[model samples]
Target: MNILNIDLYSILIAYIGIALILAKIMGSLFEKYRLPAVLGEILTGVFLGSSFISIFSPSLSWFYKDPEFHYPLEHIGHIGILLLLFISGLETDVRTLKKTGKVATISTVMGVITPFILGYIAGILMGYSNQTSMVLGALLTATSIGVTARTMMDLGVLSSDVGTASLSASVMDDFLGIIAIILAIGASSIISLAIVGVNMLLLIVLELMVGMLVIKYIMRAMEKIKTTKAILGMSFGLMLLFAAFSQMTVQAAIEGAFFAGIIIGTTAESKIINDDVKAIAYGFFIPMFFVYIGSLINLQVFTNMKAIILAVVIVIIAIVGKVIGRAVGAKMGGFNWKQSLQMGIGSIPRMEVALVSIMIAIKGGAVKGELADIFLAATMIFVTVTTLITPPLLKWSFKDEIQQNGG
Candidate 1:
């Protein structure tokens, strides 16, 4: 292979190499500063993507501009998102969720409904169509359980009443967010809405029957295989199979991937493949997904007064809605004012699921053209800002607890 003889395959290999290296370094730096590594990975893309490279190093910008580079990278990013959702499903603690009690249930409901309504109203007031507003609402309905749980663990409260409720509620929040996106996709017409409803019902039935029954045995059978990594291979294959089936029926591949995870997660073999799956996902695919999200962001949007206004308004609505809604629910669920506030702050951050919802909405044509560009950029800002602010605010909310524990 001549070093100078470059082709599309070569370009892709080179791009992946550079992206992985940069993603790892930036991710490490972010983790060192106690920030989300995903945010840093996104920033890496921004630095090398059109936002910065086009301005700082015009020659290199061609890599992003060339379709040869963009499309393949995009497909890889899709795989990353699928794996991410699968991991989310795998980590879902069904037993804990059932035991989350009335408090978690009430908080989850209000947390989802409040942000969704506020986001929709904000979108409508800003002159967006009903479908776009619905998608916007859907975007606001998820909380980043990963970020919240990590913060809680660090604060020594992951086992506290408030922490348990928040984590369980956040898990439900993801499920609702996915549902919201599906509803948004079908909201364009009455016939579409009816079809969507039917599809949802079908999905539920299938998930109950196939996911619970068939997949269990399949995983158990795979466990008998003596081949190296065979269990892992079988698990990955099941994820893809379910993803395809889900997409074919419900028009959402991630939905299938998620359900597949929940099924396999219940199997005894789940423990065996969990670490390896995460290694493949985080080490390569998931970082690329977030970076691809970053690359899609048009930094030029920030310069537009209209875009700036929209982003700011949405961010405010996101923070306020979650706090108010979850707080009230927490209070109603038997917490004091201070504890309710803590719950609210804990539920504020929205990351993977939020970003995935908006991206899917855009790709599904629920949002398009200038609106898509604007919303995408606004969402990136929203994710970054929420992820940044939640940790410090969550700590502040837990001050009394920390002080009492002698920390």
Candidate 2:
């Protein structure tokens, strides 16, 4: 194929158009299926990703041979994911989280530890080196709420007692996921650091301390902002500034925004900020990001048995890890066994944040780029299955009826 055939700009335009249209279609379809809107978008992503369609689509195969087409799309997609993480932070009720954060933190610790170790072992046993093992562990440490949130929202369990705890666990998961990525990256860089092992302990303490201080000061100033517009607008502008501040590690920026959101989510101001940012972030960047991801699909990667198997195994590990961790903790927390099991199932889907981290890890050469594709596929599967199943389970548990619809 001639280099001229690979028009970067044209691909970007095409990828965006196709992705957005697909996103809406899939979104509505999933909604009809009683699943989260995210499942549709993600399933679309996997459909776009599979080599069977992408590689042999004859005239459509132009997208695969052209990195110019896929690479930029990936970058744009990542930015979408990053902003989504920031949005996650914005949506969190910081005051309630603070009240729950400690309890959640204790649970998150239990949640991550067993999984981290199991993931590390799984990676090693699966022929992944220490480096990939660490990366594997980092990826497993995440709990993607975007996928789950859509499901929970559609099912009307998003604000219920069971739903909220699952949400809180994921919120804590996001915060911890970012920290885990940073520590994993840190650990991966200095090979000698391995002698002492990954020291996420320090990151855990420091993030909470700094996060608390940042919140105390920022919220005080935020309280004085009379116009709701100014508060939400500047908050995002600032978020992007910090996100780009460390090009190599945007986790800090993402986490910072999340913490910032949690603070406002705790206040009366939450409704104002929530109503506002929805249009701003979702309207532009998020769509761009998801579409770009669609564009990144190379359909040929699926042929690699090693990559395929590793992806499947890691995904299973991710699910088992979270289920065991959350269920056990929930039982201890006095939740019924069924409720605990439901929470475990409810937490399976991955979101934009984890995807972005995979993008960065790929770019930095910290991990294999193909791993990004694997994670995307695995996450999509989890989202689709869990989203549909969760609603029915919740319905049965709650007597299959809503006396007063929250909606």
Candidate 3:
């Protein structure tokens, strides 16, 4: 191990706090610009990235720069992402979505498959081995449902047909993404009985079934409490418990949270949980996830023209490949050109999800730091670009509706 000179704990505290504050500023600034809050977070991260920060802090050391510092908050980010997913699932209108579910499902499936294939093709062309290319495809398949959910909510369209359809689509998108991960994780074909790889597929399905049963029974047992806080708090606590038990995969915890929220419904305290917890979540923890992602980019590698070009090329293909892939899919699913484009743009951000995959790949020894860095940088760039672009595109497409609603 390399001898560490800097105080990692202190540096983490300083960095996390400063990062949160800046994220808030960036979020607000984006909101002011009529952009998605997610856009602000990503741009804040990109703007305050380690590359830019290093110019002034040459004396500062890479402490959390190592993987260990990532663990604690990485876990927390998982929690945040879980909560984000659950809250989003809670807000989804299942009945309306079931009506258009066919379109949404088809669109979402195509979104993942096309991106994966395109990313894989890009990988092979870029000289990545088959395993590397497969992992890259898996990385591209990660969709940020959190971004679209929050955007829909802010636009007061969460209950709209478009919002409902998008939510349902993302549900399938996440599920398919999980399976893509399994395939990628097992690309080397060394499966353990510990259920680390293929077993994940089984467990994810089982977790959803168990979560539904548990939520159905437990919710009825509650008898509709006077306030949602107490009940939701209990449910949230339960979510944490199950999440701890399901360390087999972050996908387990994520799907666990979604089912927990879905069974809880959005009527009573789901809104309350979202309001109370989102402040801490979107405000602090989630930004730390993005910033940590940004910090992973080592500018020293940029001195290598090959690495820089590879990173940029991957980022470009990530965007173009997914957009083109999903656009046709959405169009086939009855979306107009604009909605199809929005769906494509909406599916683009891949921060926490890709990070989770990267961590898994690294641990499983399927990928290394350079490839991981390439994926991470590519993901961050994709996220930043899409988050900034999607909101306006959405707003423009829905402007007539927004105007009619007096919003």
Compare the candidates by TM-score and give the number of the best one: 1
User: Per-residue alpha-carbon lDDT of model 1 for 1-407, expressed as tens digits?
Assistant: 77698777777798788888999899999989878888889888877678777777777676677888898888888899899889988999888767777778888889888998999899889988888888888898888876778888999988999998887787788888888787777676546767787887788678858788787778778878989999999899989998888878877888888888888899887898999999999999999988888888888877887778888988998999999999999899999889889899999898888888877887789999888888888888898899889888989989888999899
Candidates arranged by lDDT, highest first: 1, 3, 2
- Candidates 2 and 3: which is better by TM-score? 2
lDDT of each: 0.85, 0.61, 0.65
lDDT of 3 at 68: 61
lDDT digits (tens) for residues 112-132 of candidate 2 = 765667877887898766766
In model 1, the number of clashes is 0
Off by over 4 Å in 3: 1-12, 42-53, 62-71, 142-171, 186-201, 219-233, 249-252, 263-272, 334-366, 386-407
- Cα RMSD (Å) per model? 2.4, 5.7, 6.2
Candidates in order, TM-scores: namely 0.93, 0.73, 0.72
Better of 1 and 2 by TM-score: 1
Give the lDDT of residue 33 in candidate 3. 63
Positional deviation of residue 304's Cα in model 2 after best superposition, in angstroms: 2.8
In lDDT terms, how accurate is model 1? 0.85
Tell me model 3's lDDT, rounded to 2 decimals: 0.65
